[model samples]
Target: MIAQKAGGEATLLPTPAILERLETKRAIEGDRTVSGVVQRARGAAAYLYSAGVADTSSVHVDSGYLTPDDMRSLVEKGAVGDVIGRYITAEGTIADPELDARTLGLGLDELRDAAMSILVIGGEAKHPIAHAIVQHGLCSVLVTDEHTARSLLDAAPDSTTSGEDPS
Candidate 1:
């Protein structure tokens, strides 16, 4: 499970507090693994190490604010040897590892084909962004507050009862 921040002028980064809140919500909703990218590389490294999953590597994209030393500390802590430090142009797009891998010339589709789940936290303005992510097949599920969920559900196509077709 990898976490990537939502890109925009708002500077969205899933901090430890946000992750904790999301985890708690997931637990209540009967989910096990829930995580997201953090602003600090050290945080990302810590998260990956704590997860204890084999063959899994965590990435912390360069935010341009953190220094190479900071990134090195994160790497020393066990973040994946591969680190991404570049600007993504898409505003509402979720960071897909596959896309990241492609940009680095890795020539591997493991990250690209990997199934990713994103947790989006925001109000109405973020709805379209979330929708766009879903449309792009980047996120499998979206975890949001009740209000946002209601709004999305309301906007979604209505379904009829089984065996009853609405013509």
Candidate 2:
């Protein structure tokens, strides 16, 4: 399932139409449950399942930036579930190679075989993260800006691999 953050304020983001489409397609093709990592999406899933709009499972993890107790509070308030805490080293930043990689890896490992694939989409902000996702073998697909796409293509060994910033 493709899980994307809704736009606007944290509380004002619109329901993701892509998710609805995927859910609908899966339902018409056969019984399938799409999984995602957002609280509102989870609530929507519950509603959709009840209304026969779609079938889905929602998994929520603690935000790595939040304190454990605070994150637990969110879970208690029904903002999230499956409170997996952050795994960090002494540096305070994410010790994992990349943010999305850590999230995807943890999701796949904790959820076991349920996680089939991961999709990362956005602009340049997601480029490095997408690279890490590919390196970690977490996501099979990546959606990015044209500039980032060209950069990736150029970075390939078969390409020229020249005229690029090494750092």
Candidate 3:
């Protein structure tokens, strides 16, 4: 809806209802070979391929939260957040490792194939994860506010921070 308002067409994926059905099927059957699962996966992969994602130069990923605390919470107390069974953390780390395979969406390999991986996140709560993303080169480009950018620069390694040579 927002993108449409801005003149960029939005491509919506499967509805939650349809996704739930596929999830249920996956939980019961364990493989995509089962009747409907294969078709849907192929359809989605085909859609992505047709959408120019295969070119690696046009695919842009805009989701995933960067909060190490969220990962810690899920690990320490089984506490779930925005990443419970839905979102993938930076660099394809699953917030809920227990539900790793059950994640029904684009594979990390496909995402890594993209020429530009932009991570747009900010604020104190997310600083740690954002820094981690930069340190690990999880995102090719970052879009964030000034305060967070300074924080990241301060936390960055001498070689990575501005005004320092990589040698």
Runs with alpha carbons beyond 4 Å of true place in candidate 2: 1-64, 67-116, 159-167
What is the alpha-carbon lDDT of model 3 when measured against the actual structure? Answer: 0.44
Winning candidate number (lDDT): 3
- Which digits, one per residue and each the tens of the lDDT, describe model 2 over residues 110-151? 322223343434455434443444444444445556786776
Model 3 / residue 84 / CA error / Å: 11
lDDT of 1 by residue, 92-162 (tens): 22233332322321112222233543434446544544443344444445667777677766765666655
Angstrom error at residue 90, model 2: 18
Instruction: Give the distance in Å from residue 113's predicted Cα in candidate 1 to where it truly belongs.
Output: 3.4
Q: Which regions in candidate 1 have their CA more than 4 angstroms from the true location?
A: 1-112, 161-167
Better of 2 and 3 by TM-score: 3
Error of model 2, residue 125, in angstroms: 2.4
lDDT of each: 0.34, 0.33, 0.44
> Could you report the Cα RMSD, in angstroms, for every candidate shown?
16.5, 14.8, 10.2
Clashes of each: 2, 0, 0
lDDT of 1: 0.34
